[model samples]
Target: MGKLASECETERARTLTKEGISMDSEKVIKRDNEYVLHTYNRNPIALEKGHGLYAEGPEGQKYLDFTSGIGVNSLGYCDLTWAEAVSEQAHKLQHTSNLYYTAPCGKLAKKLCKRTGMNKVFFGNSGAEANEGAIKAARKYSFDHYGKGRDVVITLVNSFHGRTIATLTATGQEVFHNYFGPFNEGFVYTTAGDIEGLRELVDRHTCAIMLELIQGEGGVMALDPEYVQAVRALCDEKDLVLIVDEVQTGVGRTGTFLCCEHYNLKPDIVTLAKGLGGGLPIGAVLLNEKTAEGMGPGSHGSTFGGNPVVCAGANVVVDRMDQSFLANVSERAVQLRAGLAKLPMVKNLSGIGLMVGIEFFGGIQAADVLAACREKGLLVLTAKSRLRLLPPLTLTAHDVEKALGILNEVLTEMEQKAPKEQA
Candidate 1:
C-alpha cells in the first residue's frame, strides 16, 4: 500500500524483437509499463538479485531493504535453506491439485497446527484468500447452528483485510471504498478500543467479529490488550466466532508466531500470510476445533492453494522463527525502538517486533522522507501518513545501526529545514 518515491513513467523507444535482448532495470520498467497492469505505482529501481538484508538494482546499486518487499521476503532473499527447499520440491513435485495428496502441503499444515495449537488449516495463495476462507467458515458455522439472519460480521475501523471484494467489504477503511461500488454486504465496523461502540454494532445478527491485533496498514496501531479481552468475552457470551487476521502480524513478525499469543488469545480462526513462505506466495486459515467441522469438503477449494514448492519454502521459513530467533527479534525491536524514539523527527512510534510505523512532527510528509531514504539507498514503506518499516527479521545489528544513522541524518535535516522554510 506504499507509493514509489518517483513514478515509473520514463519513456524509452525500444521494443523487444525476435532476437531476445537481455533487459536491464530501465528496460525492465519499460517492458512492465508495456505489458503489466497499471494497478500498482511501483518503485523505479528494478532489482536484479538479493542476499541477506540487501538487494541489488539493475546497475548493481546495493539497497538495504527495510521494506523486505512489504514483509514477504522473510529470510531476506535467496536464503539457502528456503531456496533449497523450494528448489527440491519443484524438482520432486511442483504442484498437486486439491484432488490429490501432497507431502509438503500436509507436512506444512501439520507443523502450523502443532505450533499454533490450532485444530486444522486451510492453505491458500495469499492473505486475502485466507481471510475469505475464514469468513466463509464463520458464516457456515453460524448457519449450521444459529440459523438465518445471523451472518453479519463486525470489524474495527482503520483495519485492512485485503483487496478481494468480500475482504475489501470487510475492511473498515472508507478510503478503500473507491470505484468498487456495491461491495458485498453483511459487514459492519467499530472504532478501535471502543467497547461501547463494539457493543452497539453487535446484535443477534452478528455471527463473527474479525480483527487484526495490530492494524498494520492503518498506521500500525495496536489495540489495547484489555479491549481485545473484552471482545473475546463478548464473542464467548454470544457464541459468536472470533477471527484474527494475522496476515501481516503473524509468523514471528510480532516477536511471536501470532500477535494474539501476546494477548493470551485462542480465537476460533486465525489467518496468516506475508512472511509465511519466505519469498514465495502462501497463506493459511487456522481453525480451532469449534469451527473446524464447519468447513466440510466441497464447501471451499483452491487449485493452486497448497502447491508443494510453496509449502516447502514455507516450512523452512517457519523453522527459522523458532524460540531463539523470536527472542532475537524482540531484542532487536527494543534496540530499534529506543533508537527511533530518540530521533528529533520521530513524533510517535507504534508496532511490535520488526514491524514498525514512524510519524514525523516537523511538518515532513511521509512520502518526502521516504523519497530521501530511497535516494540514500534505503527502501521503506508508508501506511496511511506514517512511514512504515518491515525490515527483515534476519537483519544484522550493524545494519540496524546503519539504517538508524540514515534516518537520524534525514530527520535532523528535516527538522532544520522546517524552521528555515517557515521563516
Candidate 2:
C-alpha cells in the first residue's frame, strides 16, 4: 500500500526528530552533529539557499558572504551562466572514463594552457591531489634526467600545500605535522624571503622548490617580489624545478590569472584548484616545457579528474577571467582595501586583489569577530590569528561598502566590550 503525501511528510518530520518536530536550523545542526564526523568547527547557522553574493540560513536569515566558500565561488552563488553550463553538460554527458575523450575537459584544458602559456595539463579532484601529482612530476623529472637521489623539494615556511600525506609533508608548518606519522621525506623548509637560507637548503639531492606567492593559510602574507625573483633565478641556476602552489591565489582570486603574474615570474609547474571550477571540485597542474614530459602514459591519473560537468563550469569561469574582468577585480580590491583601512580597529592589512588579511589592535579575537559579523548578516573567515577575507571577484564597490560597514560595526562593538587592559 502506498502512503499518502501527508503521511510521508509526517514520517520525514518524525525521522528528523523523535518528537515529530519540523526540521529547522537547530534540528539540522543536531542531526549533523550526531551523524557527521567532528572534523570542522562548524558555524551555528545551517545554510539553506544562496544567490549572487548572499546566502540564507534555514530560518531565512540573510548573510552577505565574503568567504565565497573559501574562494571557490568565483562567479558568486549559482551564477546563471555557470549553472546553465554545468546543467547542460550534466544532461548531455555527465561523465566518462579517462580512456575516452570529452569536449568539456579538452576545452577547459586548452583555455588554461592558452592563458598560462603552459605546455601540458593534468587534472585532479582537489588541491591536494594536484600537488601530489606535482610532487610526483618534479621527482620523476629529476629521476629521468639526473637520478633518484635528487628528490628533495624545498618549500617555504608558513606555506600550505594540501592535506594529502605528501602535500602535508610538503607544507612547512609544524602544526599540520601531527597525527600523520612517517610522512614522506625529501621535503625541506625555508623561511619566506630567506634567499640565503634557501640556498643553504638546496643541494644535489634537491629536485624542486615549491611555494605559494601569497600564504593564504599563514596569515595571507604576500611574498616579496624580489625574493620570488631570486628563487626563480636560483631554480634556473640550480636546474631545480619551480612549482608554485596557486590553489588559493589562482583563477582571478588575486586579480590575476595566476599570482606569479604579479612578479613576472614563471615556473616549471603550477598547481591550481580553489577558484578554477567556480563552485565545483577541480584541480590542474600546469607543466612548462622544462617538465612537460614528466608524467607519461600510466604514470599518474585520476578517475574523476576531468569530470564533464565540473570542466563545463570551469570553462565558463576561465572565460570570465578575461583581462577586463580581472582589471575590475583589481579595482574592487583597491576599493575593498581602502574601505578596510578606514576602519578604526584594523591595525594592518595584507594581500593582493580580493585576497585580504586583517590584523586588529586592542587584542581582538578573530573567532569573536566572525561570530559577531555572522549575527549581523555578514560572513567572514579567519586565517591564523587574523581575519581573512576572500570575497568574490565579482564584488562591487557597493558590496564592499556593505561588508565594511558590518565589519566596522562588529569591531566597534568588540572594542567597546573589551577589557581595559586588552583595549
Candidate 3:
C-alpha cells in the first residue's frame, strides 16, 4: 500500500511538470511578445526558480546554470545568508535618499574601501552608471588641474563599457555606435596590448587610458602583463588617470578580489558591478584620494543608489568571498579548463578563474553549442565566437563535473555534425 502511494505521488509530480503552473511555454512567449518590449532576444524557456547551481524553468525542467545571470549571482541563487540579510534590511528599511546617511551603505562603503585600499566610493545602480561616474570624475580631474584641451579618454579596441551616452562612446566596439546619433566626443580606441599605439594616441588632449583586465564580451581575452605595465608607466609619465573597468572581473571572479591584482598594478579609478550586490543591482566607482576630491557637492547623484537592502546583500557576498573562498575559485578554474581542453571540438580555452571562454573549430557556432547544452539541461553564455561560462563561485565539484559532462556531450555532437574537410 505504501509503495502504491509513493508511485501515485510520483505520477502527480510528473503531471504537474507537464502541465506547468498556468500554461505552456508557447502561450507564455506569445503573451510576453504582446506585452513586453522587443529588447532582448530571449530564449524559448522562462526561468521560475533557482538554487545553488541549478535553475528550473516554468515547465519544471532542471538545468545546471553556468551563466549565473551573466556573473551577477556570485553566491548563487537564494543564498541563505544573503537572502536573510536582504530580507532583514528589506523589512527594516528598504531605501533612503543619499541626502541622509544609512548604516548599511556606510558599512558597505567602508568595507569596500578597506578591502580595495581605495580612498572613497560613489554608488550607482548599474555598471554603466559606475563607469559614467568614473568618466565624469576623470574628466573633471583633468579639467580642474590641467585646464582645457585635456578631454580625450583612450580606451582599447573591442572593449566593452557601459551603454550610457558617455560609456557607449567609451566602448570601442563600432557595433554599439549605431542608432544613437551624435555620441559624446573625446573618446578614442587603440588596439589592445599595443603600447606604441597608445603612446601615439596620447597627446595634449588625452586625459585617461581605460581598460578591462579581461575582455569579457570580446571573448575573454586577458591583457599581457608587460603591455599592462607599459600602459601604467605611460599613464604615470603623462599624468593621465588610469581607469580599470572591473564590472565583470571584480569581486573574486579572477581568483582575486580585483583582477588588477593579478597584474600587480593599481588604477586611479576602478569601476565595479555585476557581482558586488550578489543578485541585487548595485554599481560603484572606487577612486583614489586626489581624483576622488574632484567631485564636489551637487556634481552627481542617483536616487536609488546605495539602497540599504542591496548593501545588506552585498555585505553577505563580501563576507563570503574571503581568501579561502577565492582559493576555491582558482581550483575550480583549473578543473574546468582541463576538462574543457579534452573535448574534441574545443580548439582553445581562455580566461582566468571561473570566467571561462571555449573556442571551437570546424565553424561550429557558439549558439548551436549553447542550444545543445540547454537541451541537455545545462545553461551557458556566448561571447561573439566563443562559448562563455561564468558559473557561480560557490558551485561544488560535483556540480562542475555534471555541467562539464553535458558540455562535452554537446561539443561532441556539434563536431560530428560538421561537414568533412576537402582533401
Q: TM-scores, in order shown?
A: 0.94, 0.94, 0.94
Ranking by lDDT: 2, 3, 1
Q: Which of the numbered candidates is closest to the native, going by highest lDDT? A: 2
Give the range of the ten consecutive residues with the poorest summed lDDT in model 2: 1-10
Which residue segments of model 1 deviate by more than 4 Å?
1-20, 420-423
Tens digits of per-residue lDDT for model 2, 36-135: 9998999989987788899988677899999999999999998888887887788799989799999999999899999999999999999999999999
* N/CA/C clash count, model 2: 0
User: Which whole-number lDDT from 0 to 100 does residue 92 have in model 1?
Assistant: 82
Give the local distance difference test score of model 3. Answer: 0.90
What is the C-alpha lDDT profile of model 1 across 322-402, one tens digit per residue?
A: 889998888888988999999977778998888899988857889988989888888999999999999888877788898
What ranges in model 2 sit over 4 Å off? 1-22, 419-423
Please report, in order, the local distance difference test score of every candidate based on alpha carbons.
0.89, 0.91, 0.90
Clashing pairs in 3: none
Alpha-carbon error at 231 in model 3, in Å?
Answer: 0.6
